[model samples]
Target: MDFDNFKTLGEWDKWKGALAKAVDLGEAIGFNENTVDKMAYRIGNFLSSTVDPENREERVLQELWKVADESDKKVLAKLIVRMVEKDSRLH
Candidate 1:
């Protein structure tokens, strides 16, 4: 499910599902709702900045850091990158 074009309720539903999955992953790795929310927010923005889509590890990390708190930033970046990377591997 892509969020770049998500505008309608149906699209949001899909995004919500994906967000849930990400949150689940976060919890699996020892993150709380507040922390996961920050990560999900970063993920949304990162997906929106899709240019070539292959990915820039540093750029993604930096953006996630920019959106997340000092303490949560690294953890959130790791979660988001791993999610995108894992999905990309299947594709």
Candidate 2:
């Protein structure tokens, strides 16, 4: 995926779609849920540190990330993975 293009788009649906794609790709590559969740946590940390929030949802997540401890961040990342997975299953 072209992350630069995605950053420019800044739409919540696009963000969610990208996340769903990541989840799908992880599954396709035989990553277990734990592995996927860990990857998500790393990605979340990277984004929170390096990327500015472009929308309200992202801003909210950024805020949450700022206050969350390490374990809480992991839970948040897992929740994100689960959210996209469930959404993918529905569609």
Candidate 3:
């Protein structure tokens, strides 16, 4: 996946759509939930460190990330994965 394209479409919905696609791809390629959750955690860490939030939701997430402990962050990552999974199902 070329995230350069996604960077251009910077809306929160676009971000969620990209996440949904990534989740689908991961599943299609036989990544288990734990693997995917770890991937999401890494991505979240990277984004929190390197990227400014593009929207209110993202800003909120960044703020939460700033305050969360490792275990909490993992739980947050899991919730995000579940959220996107449910979101993708709706579309």
Q: Which candidate has the highest TM-score of all? A: 3
lDDT of 3 by residue, 1-91 (tens): 9886466556877889899999999999999999999999999999999999876789999999989999999999999999989989998
Q: Which stretches of candidate 3 lie above 4 Å from their native place?
A: 1-10
Model 2 per-residue lDDT at 1: 75
lDDT against true structure, model 3: 0.90
Greater lDDT among 1 and 3 belongs to: 3
Off by over 4 Å in 1: 1-12, 51-91
Query: Could you tell me the TM-score of candidate 2?
Result: 0.86
The Cα local distance difference test for each model comes to 0.56, 0.89, 0.90
Candidate 3, residue 15: Cα displacement in angstroms equals 0.7
Candidate 3, residue 3: Cα displacement in angstroms equals: 27
Task: Show the colliding residue pairs in model 1.
Answer: none
Q: How many clashes does each candidate structure show, in the order listed?
A: 0, 0, 0
- lDDT string, candidate 2, 1-91, tens digits: 7786565555877788889999999989999989999999999999999999987788899999989999999999999998888878887
Clashing pairs in 3: none
Q: In candidate 2, which residue ranges exceed 4 Å CA deviation? A: 1-10
